[model samples]
Target: MSNDVKPGRAAAIKSALESAFIALLASGVCLWFLISETQASDDGDPAKLTMLAIGLSAGLCAHFVYMAIAAKRAERNATLWVILMVVLMPFTSVVLGILLFNQVQEIEQQAREEGGAGSAA
Candidate 1:
């Protein structure tokens, strides 16, 4: 398979990012609801339990989606990059994502130039 993303794949990646954003928002809402329910009730409630489950699951899903998207942007040493991202999350991961994207863009540009040169030759 080609490493370069096609227009359709780009659209899919965009959709995934959008979905991940929504999932993250939902996770926050669930957390708020859980906190409120826990504060109001003296005893453990099924509604609160459900909210807790939803919040945790949504957060986990969002993290995985973000990792997958970032991994795709990494060309060289992708597995190592992904492993490091998981180890140093939040701040470091964001920085790594930006760097990885730049690396991928540079690689694609080089490939395009090489292809053009070959065609001309």
Candidate 2:
């Protein structure tokens, strides 16, 4: 692969990781709001809580879609990644992102070494 393509793939994976992290953060905030509202004596504003829930869902969905696209671009199993992201949204994303990033780096390094050897010969 061209050096340019390698960076583009890496950037896409990084962007996906960022998206997942944002979604995970939003999930935490949403959970905190839910717990606080339940524990408080006074009723919390339903509209605000509803809006927060909606935003959290949207963030998660965006993360899933972005990650799937990134995985596909990286020649990884997009469907499997999406399923894992959906099933374990809060915990699995960062691990998978790191694995994918490392895999891409390894691939790039191997390609570079091979190309160098081929040209030298």
Candidate 3:
């Protein structure tokens, strides 16, 4: 019930937000490239395209790893989250990140309440 936030929870929330933002940015870049008139093999630069693809992959991978670690720390099923995120990356990464973030917040809040109660007794 206290407004004060723990450093660990704050860090976790920041990490989740950052990962989600990176995934969203990468997805937007890929979408823009797909809709643009640039052809990777033609007048367009294939090297630039390759770099963009690599960036997108890296962002997705980072998001997946973050989720997996967060799930494990929150006592959730890390394997299930990792599999789901991998199968639905670039499109569902942000959603999954938000879900995990909320779950972590809830878990932290419950722990705080329990600790406060124990201390009060």
Best by lDDT: 2
Worst 10 residues of 3 by lDDT: 1-10
Q: Candidate 3 lDDT (Cα, whole model)? A: 0.65
> CA shift at 119, candidate 2, in angstroms?
12
Each candidate's clash count: 0, 0, 0
Question: Please, what's the RMSD in Å of model 3?
Answer: 5.4
TM-scores for the candidates: 0.52, 0.70, 0.61
lDDT by residue (14-115, candidate 3, tens digit) is 575666566657766775774462654456677776766776677667667766766665556779877877787645656666775676577577778878
> Candidate 1: which stretches are off by over 4 Å?
1-5, 73-89, 92-121
Count: clashes, candidate 3? 0
Q: Ten-residue segment with the worst summed lDDT in candidate 1? A: 5-14
Model 3, residue 84: distance off in Å is 1.0
Question: Which candidate do you rate higher for lDDT, 2 or 3?
Answer: 2
Q: Best candidate, TM-score-wise? A: 2
